[model samples]
Target: MQKSRLLMKFQSSGHTTAVLRAMSYASPSSKLKDMTSGIEFYDKITYIEEHFEEEKDVLVQKL
Candidate 1:
């Protein structure tokens, strides 16, 4: 159960990172409109990646 939970969290974090990466390349007007929210999402991804490094590292290795 704990392993499944960790995997779920790691997958969600990866999705969050993908969204932020997309936002990082958005058009200037869209970026300006959403920059603050995008930053928050990015920060959340960083926090999760830092706190759950083991799970994240496994995912990275698999990919």
Candidate 2:
């Protein structure tokens, strides 16, 4: 069964929330062991946002 259909069958909000939390715990993105890596990712995106006007939507390249 598709996840969306499974989610929709829940008539109770509490059950839905519990299932969603369980699914979140099981997801791959929840496995980041290094907190600093998340902070670095945030810093990178903010740096790009601050410089977006200068880049003018140009493809960012790594040197």
Candidate 3:
């Protein structure tokens, strides 16, 4: 049991670090405007990886 808990703690910490790194490298949102119509468009932004989400879900369940 002790080993299992320790493994989980390590995995959680690693996933957290990965999430932070991914967020730091993700591109900031950018806006674009049409020259003729003067309409603005915004790009969809991604802050984290999908694998992180899955890892988090698993960690939460284990806890």
Candidate 4:
């Protein structure tokens, strides 16, 4: 168990690092847009996104 736990500690491989870097470099909204491109899902995605934007605005206003 100790040996496996030690192995698991270094969980990320080069591929994982590459993927994280790519995702970090892109705008998160663009990533969401890629997944929500279908017509049926677009409206639902936008509605949820609007709520997120509203919450962000409120937090920013408080600050």
Q: Which candidate tops lDDT?
A: 1
lDDT (C-alpha) at residue 6 in model 1: 42
* Tens-place lDDT digits, model 3, residues 1-63: 433443454476766534543554453321111111111110111111335564677657766
Residue 10's lDDT within candidate 3 is 43
Instruction: Give the per-residue lDDT digits (tens) of candidate 1, residues 12-56.
Output: 687774565566676665465334444544454556566775677
Worst 10 residues of 1 by lDDT: 33-42
- The TM-score values for the models, in the order shown, are 0.26, 0.31, 0.23, 0.24
Find the number of clashing residue pairs for candidate 2.
Answer: 0
Candidate 3: residue 54 Cα off by (Å): 44
Candidate 2 least-lDDT 10 residues: 31-40
Q: In model 3, what is the error at residue 46, expressed in angstroms? A: 30
Ranking 2 against 3 by lDDT, winner: 2
Question: Candidate 3 vs candidate 4: which has greater TM-score?
Answer: 4
Candidate with more favorable, higher TM-score: 1 or 3: 1
lDDT of 2 by residue, 4-44 (tens): 33334433455644554455456655324211223333445
Best-to-worst order by lDDT is 1, 4, 2, 3
